[model samples]
Each structure stands twice: as structure tokens, then as C-alpha cells.
Target: MKNSQLYIITLVVLTFLGCKELEPRRPKEHSTTNFYKEVIEQNKKLNALETKRIKQTLDRDTLTTYQSSANGFWYTYINKDTVSSQTPIKGDIVTVKYNVTGLQGNQFYDYQTRDYTVDKEDFVPGLTEGIKLMKKGETITFVIPSYRAYGVTGDGSRIGINQTLRSTLTLIEIKKPNNETK
Candidate 1:
């Protein structure tokens, strides 16, 4: 699977989790009882299905399974070149300029505030993880899955479910949101 394709799959999970669907017996918090267990099982099957779909649809002969960390809400990768480590942590305010696109190459979120929230539960899982992996003046690309994004219900017109998302993220700057000093 290509990174781009992997990104889409992750977005699906992200969006699915982000969706606040109200179930009759569902609690206020995100519902795990409704379909998460089944959903996870389905996701495993779907992942395989997606891998096949991508390889067949794109006619990719040299496709490799693109992998993302399954443990955390967020993950990061240093550019193949950069060496230093100044990893981002929770509560770190950051400024980023990004362009989110889909498989057909549709534009989504354009650059706005670099100091956006790094909240895991707010945005999709892939995005929440992809952004915090940068330093001042750094750019990275992400291929997020729908599950990790807006899921099937999606967030109005801004995002769609089961649709893979592509992003070229540039970390403009990193600063504390409320704190004035170190």
C-alpha cells in the first residue's frame, strides 16, 4: 500500500472515531459499545479489502503495505534527512499551514492558523499525529485514512467518509498557547 493510500485508511478510522453519533443507549462520550469492537474487526477485513482495492484499481504491481502506529492516537516520522530531536508533546501550541486533498486531488483545509489545537480527539487521528512531528520550519506529507479522519458520516462538506485524504503539512512555528515564558 502506498503512503497516500494508507493515509486514507487512517482517515476513515479518525473520522469514524471523531463522529459524535447519538445512540439511544450510547453514553455522551464516543461510543465504543455500538460498533467499535465490530468496527475494529471490520476494519481488519476492510484494511485487507482496501489494500486489494488500491492495488487493483491503481494497477500497482510494486505496492507495499503502508504502515502506521496502531498503539497511539498520534505518531510522527522525521524526514529521511533531518537528525535532531525536539519532539512535540501534549499541550504544545503550534502553527501550521497545510493543504488537505483527496484521492481525486480535491482541496480541503487550506493554511489558516499555525497555532491550532493539538487535540487528539478534536481532529482525526492521523492529522493529530502527523502535525506534532515537526520542528520550526518543517514540512511533511501525510496520507490519512477515512477511519482516522471524518469517517463515513464526515463533517459536513469539509470532509467525507471512506475517502482517503492527502496532505502536505508545513510546520511554521511552535509556541505555547497560554504560557508567555519557558
Candidate 2:
């Protein structure tokens, strides 16, 4: 109908009339320099507080240190980059995916399979700490210190204390006896 056509034309004109490209904001309008500056200041303050807390909680003489706090929660590697954390409980058989490098930066193991759960008692304090913080497929880097590791006496094997071991671990699955699993 003629009336219907007129209405359609009017609708089309109204829709097109206000169509315009969006204007980009000026630098001043989009400037987030102030916001970033505030965030940086806050981060610095937090870092200072964390540093103090770590110093108070950790023993400078000991190689392996455990931290449980809101500021930071991790077992810092003392002598080497040996990963560790106490969150997963000590003496648990945890499935892990890991890549390990020696103090000389030699890649000893870089296994990436889903079947890598290690016994807590078998691993050093550092490794135990690391396993606690892992979830399925979560990768983490550990800069283990000497105390939580094979110390000055060494593990009588490949790893030693005062040695920084680098380990990137992924938790594939957690398993134990009496638990149904595939």
C-alpha cells in the first residue's frame, strides 16, 4: 500500500540519517598515564612489604625456606633454582610434568607426559613445595636454592646445593592408592 511504502521510506531515512563513523578520542582523552602511575606506586609498596615479610620469615642461613602468608606463599629456592612449595602437603604421590636443568644449565630431563607423579618423600623439600602448588596442566618455574636441595653435601648424585636448578613443572593428574583412575 502507498501508506506502507511511505512508512518504510521514512524508517530507512531515519536509520541512515544518524549513521556516522565513531570519532577517535584524543591522546588527552585516552591518556592512562595517571592510572598506571598509581598502580606502579601500589605495586612498589606491596613489594617492599613482601620483602620485609620474607626476611622475617626465612632463615638466611638455611637454604630451603617456606612461606605461608597473604603477601606471598612459596618456598623460595636458596642455593639453586629447585622448585618447591608446601601447599600440596609433604609425602604425597603427585603426578607431574617437568623439565629440569642442572646448575651448569644442562637440560637433564624435559619429560612432557601425563604420567609424572613423584612421591613426596623421594623428592627434596624444594620439589615437594613445587608439587603442592600445581594443578592439572599448570606449568611453573622453580629457582631452587641450595638448602631445600642436595645442599653442600649434594644428593650424592646429579643435583647439589648452592646450585640453582631450573624446573618447569606441569601437574597432569594427582593419584594415590584406593582412588579410581584411568
Candidate 3:
């Protein structure tokens, strides 16, 4: 009787221990919200630093007065078209002669003329908007931030990653589309 009672007590203890509730194991560090917040904060810091550097470079140039654009870039008219106020519209074929340089005055590309359909073809985002602000025979110098120009990945050959650029663009001509009347 004593042995049987001992065996029954052991079985009861084992059953009680095994009946304890089971729970799912949770990871200690699984939240992505904190990681994304850190990324955003780092990007803001980077943008602020880049803006400061660009402002310093602009301040050193006394020969030209830079005007900030609504699209997050800066520009100055090298040769303003005072007579004809017409600028290129969307779908207009525009011929432009341009040269690209770094903020430190390092030339990436020499002056070259090319034709593009405004807002239709793929081009530098800043230059595309700047070209809309130009008229035929007018030249303008644009100081573009990296985000507005090339972002992170650059043009592969000349412009490096996240490099600010200074480009002088001359509107050679603007050919309006055939469907539109002059």
C-alpha cells in the first residue's frame, strides 16, 4: 500500500507539471519601426549637410546671384531672353547645349548639344524642370542637389554617387508639337 501511494503521488506530480500552459516564443528584437526611424533620421542629417556645403559654395561666388527654385535647386540666368518670354512646354522638342561640373568646379562633361522632348524622355530631374524655365537662346546655370539630380546611384561614368552638380544649359531652340497652333 505504501509503494502504491508513493507511485500515485509521483504520477500526480508529473501530471501537474506537464499541464502547465504552453506559450509561443517571441523574438527579443523584432520591431522594424525603430530601424526605419533611424534610417529617416540619418537621411535628414545627410540632406542638411549637403545643403550646407552647397550654400557655402554658392556664397563664395560673388560674380553670380543664385535664386532658389521651388523644386529644391538653385539657378541664375547666364543669358536671359528679355525679348521673347516664351518657354518650352510639354511635348516641345528642345535643343540644349549643356555642361556638367561638380560643386568644386570639377568638369564631368564638356559642353554638348542634344535634343529632347520635354517631360517625355528620361533626363536629369533638375535639368528637366530648369529647362522649362528657359527660352530660346537663353542660357542658365543650375546648381542642383544630389537628390534632385541623380539621387544615390549616379550616371555610372562621370557623376559619382550623391554628387552635387553645376550645369550650364543653353536653350538652343524649342520646336512646338504639330497638334498645337502657334
Candidate 4:
């Protein structure tokens, strides 16, 4: 009985000693400054590439009359209808038809006619600015850089990362803030 107990104790001790205690895995530590620097550098590179691609597209399409906007998008009105000369403000609701495309001419979305409130935060900066330049019945075409559209992290699907977007907007109607609820 003593021999068996001794053997058991020895076995237990051997087993306990042989077994390794599991350590919790810790993620690698990175400096925030370094991470921020890397992000800034990557943004610079992406901007450079996007600019080059835009230049190439403009050259290929032979687009020379596009006026550069203060916010970096290139735009030109294709047609202007002699309706109301009044453009939209932030509180005004605007009815528009738009076709959004990529630099390679891939269409993203097309709306024959839709209504949107002129909220800058709700849409891309390029589209918001583009709409502000239009009056009722005016149609404008805009070539938006990636920074103004989806930016570095795209729209999570058809639009890839750092992709430039081209969009054409036709303002169908403009409703005043008091008349917009209907």
C-alpha cells in the first residue's frame, strides 16, 4: 500500500512538474506616434497616386474645360435649364437625379429623380459642394477625388480603397424649408 502511494505521489509530482502553465497571449505593443506617422505617410502616398490617376483620366478623356473648385473637385455644367435662378441652402430640400461613377467609368448608383435635404454631413463633401453650385434644372458633372468622396476606406464594397469618383447631378426642383415636409 505504501509502495503504491509512493508511486502515485511520484507520478503526480512528475506530471505536475512536466506540465507547463499556460500564459495568456498579449498583443504586440505599438507606439501611437509611430502609428500616426505611418498613417500620415500612407495618406500622402495615396493622395499622390490619386492625383496621378486623375491626371491620366483627364488626359485620356480630353477634358479641358472643367473648372477646378476650391475644394479640389473638378466640375462643369453640361446643361442649364432656364428655371428658377435660386440655388439651395442647407435647410432647403432639393430634388435631383444623379449618376455616380468611378474613374474607370464604372457606375455605382443612378437615381432618375430623388429628393435629398442639403445636409453636408449626410453625403460626400464633393456631392454636397456640387449640389450647392446648381440651381433648379441645372445639370453639373463633377470629378471628385478620393479624399472628397469615400477617402482611404471606401464605401465597403464596389468602391475600393482610395478610389476617385465621378458624378453627374441634375437638379430637378428646389423646395423651400417651409415646403419641404411634404
Candidate 5:
């Protein structure tokens, strides 16, 4: 009887241990919500710092008056075509000669001439809007923020990540769409 009782107790203990509740395995890492929130906060801080730096640069420049664009960039005309009222429309092909420089005026790209179909081609985001603001024979120097210029990933060549750019653009010609006669 003693042996049977001891065996029964051991069996009961083993059964209980073996029937332990199974739980779903959880990841050791943090939740995605927390990670996204951290990314947003970091981006906010970066944007603020970049904006402050841009403002400081603008403050020091007394030679040119920069006009703030509604699209979140600043521009000053190098050569304004006051006589011509026409600007590039959505489908108009525009020929431009432009050069890119850093905020401190270090050249990233030399003067290159390219023809772009306005609002229809892949070009610099800020400059796309900047082009529409120009008439033929107008030259404008645009100060673009990093987010509007290249965002986190840059042009993958000379421009680095989160680098703001100053581009001097000359609108060489604005060719109207074939549907519209000159």
C-alpha cells in the first residue's frame, strides 16, 4: 500500500507538470507603435534643427531678399522677366540650365542644361514647382529645404542625405504643347 500510494503521488505530480498551460510565444522586441512614434519624434527634431539652420543662413544674407514660397521653399530672382507674363503650364516643355550647391555654396553639380516636361517629368521636387513660377528668360536662385529637396535619401551621387540645396536656374525656353498654337 505504501509503495502504491508513493507511485500514485509521483504520477499525479508528473501529470500536473506535463499539463502545464501552453502560452503563445511573444517577441522580445518592442511594439511597432512605439517604434513608429520614436521615428516621428526623431523626424520632428531633425526638421526643427534644419529649419533653424536655414533661417540662420537667410538672416546673414543681406545682399538678396528671399521670397518664401507657399510650397515651403524660398527664392530670389537673379533675372526677372517683368515684361513677359507667361509661365510654364502643366504640359509645357521647359528648357533649363541649372547648377546645384550646398547651403554654404559648395557646388554639387555643375551647370547642366536639360529639357523637362513641367509637372510631367521626374525632376527635383522643389525645382518642379519653382519652374512653374518662372517665365522664359528668367533666372531664379532657389533655397530649398532638405525634405523638399531630397528627403532622407539623397540623389545617391554628390548630394548627401538630408543636405539642403541652392540651385540657380535659368529658364531658357518654354515650349507650348503641340495642341496649342503660338
Candidate 6:
């Protein structure tokens, strides 16, 4: 009877130990609000520095004048054909010859010889909005802030954290979707 009692106690202790190991550990902090606030503050500081850098670059350039939109991106036409024509709206398939570079003049991606569709959500918000302000066969250069470009996380390769981007886009074609598809 004493041997059986010892065996039962050992079994119970082993079972409790196994259950404790199986349980998930809880984090010290339940809320990530402070972490998110820190990220936002960092982004804001980086964005301010980038904006100043872009403005300085523009000021030193004697070749072209830059302009800003309500969406907070700077743009200037390299070559413009028509300004009175219709701009590309939503559901418009646009082909653009483009080049993208960082604020420090490091080239990231370029497709000068090819064409890409202009989906509303596919491209960065700044590029999309910049394209909408251009007519067909027009070339425009623009500066996209970090928030509007890749944001804090970036594109994961050439673009780094909180990096602003500069792009030159030439709108080659614009094909609006039909009413049935819309």
C-alpha cells in the first residue's frame, strides 16, 4: 500500500509539471499603445528631415521649378504635352515609363522602357496621386514623403525605414474602363 501511494504521488507531480510546461507564457505589457506612439514620433521626425532635404535640393536646382499638391508631394513637369485634357481617373489603365530614386540620389527601381498598370491601391499613394495630375504623354518628376511613399517599413529591399523617394513618371497611355466594368 505504501509503494502504491508513492507511485500515485509521483504520477500526480509529473502530470502537474507537464501541464505547467504546456501553458503559454503571458507578456508583461498587455497594450502596445506606447510602442505605436513611439513609432509615430520617430516617423514624424524623419519626415521633417526629409522634407527639409527635398526643399534644399529643389532650391539648388536651376534647371526646373517644383510645385506641391494638396496631398503634400512635390512635382514638376519635365516634358508636358497637354494640360487641358482629361486626367486619369479611377479604373484607368495607365502605362508609365518611370524611374525611382532615394532622396540622396540612390536609384532603387526604374522601368523606363516598359509599361505598368496604374491600379489605385497597387502603387504608393503619392505616385498614384501624382499620376492623376498628369495628362497622357506628359513626363513629371516628383518627391514623395516617407508616409506617402513606403512609410516606416519600406519596400523591404532598396528602400529603407522612413525613407523618402523621388520618381520621374512619363504617362504614356491611359485607357479608362468601360461603364459595364465600372
Compared with the true structure, all predictions reach lDDT values of: 0.63, 0.56, 0.92, 0.82, 0.92, 0.81
Q: Could you tell which candidate, 1 or 4, scores higher by TM-score?
A: 4
- Clashes per candidate (backbone, < 3 Å): 35, 24, 0, 0, 0, 0
Provide TM-scores for the models: 0.59, 0.44, 0.83, 0.73, 0.87, 0.71
What is the overall TM-score of model 1 with all chains considered together? 0.59
Model 4 Cα lDDT, one tens digit per residue, 97-179: 98888877898876567788887347767888889888877888899998999887988877877778988889888888789
* Candidate 6 residue-pair clash tally: 0
Better of 4 and 6 by TM-score: 4
Candidate 6 structure lDDT? 0.81
Provide the lowest-lDDT 10-residue window in model 6. Answer: 173-182
Model 3 alpha-carbon drift over 4 Å, by segment: 1-21, 27-29, 179-182
> Per-residue lDDT tens digits of candidate 3, residues 99-177?
9999888999999999989999998999999999998999999999999988899998989999999999999888887
- Comparing 2 with 3 on TM-score, the higher-scoring candidate is 3
Best by TM-score: 5
Evaluate residue 178 in candidate 5 and report its C-alpha lDDT on the 0 to 100 scale.
82
Query: What's the lDDT of the predicted structure labeled candidate 1?
Result: 0.63
Q: What C-alpha RMSD separates each model from the true structure?
A: 24.1, 18.3, 3.4, 5.6, 2.8, 6.8
For model 2, give the 10-residue run with minimal summed lDDT. Answer: 69-78
What digit string (tens of lDDT, one per residue) describes model 6 on residues 1-182? 99999999999999998877566778787568988999889868877888888899888988879998899899998888764577787778777889889876799986664543555457777998898888888999889988888887999888887778889889878776552311
Point out where model 2 deviates above 4 Å: 1-92, 112-120
Give the C-alpha miss distance for residue 96 in model 2, angstroms: 1.3
Please report, as a residue range, the 10-residue window in candidate 4 with the lowest summed lDDT: 56-65
Clashing pairs in 3: none
If both were scored by lDDT, which would come out higher, candidate 3 or candidate 4? 3
lDDT of 1 by residue, 1-182 (tens): 69999999999999998897866875567666767788788888876665455445334423433335452222233343266556456777666777777755788777555556567337656778876666666766666656676767877888876776766677766666575321
- Candidate 2 per-residue lDDT, tens place, 7-33, comes to 999999988986867688766565489
What are the clashing pairs of model 4? none
Question: Order of all candidates by TM-score, from best down to worst?
Answer: 5, 3, 4, 6, 1, 2
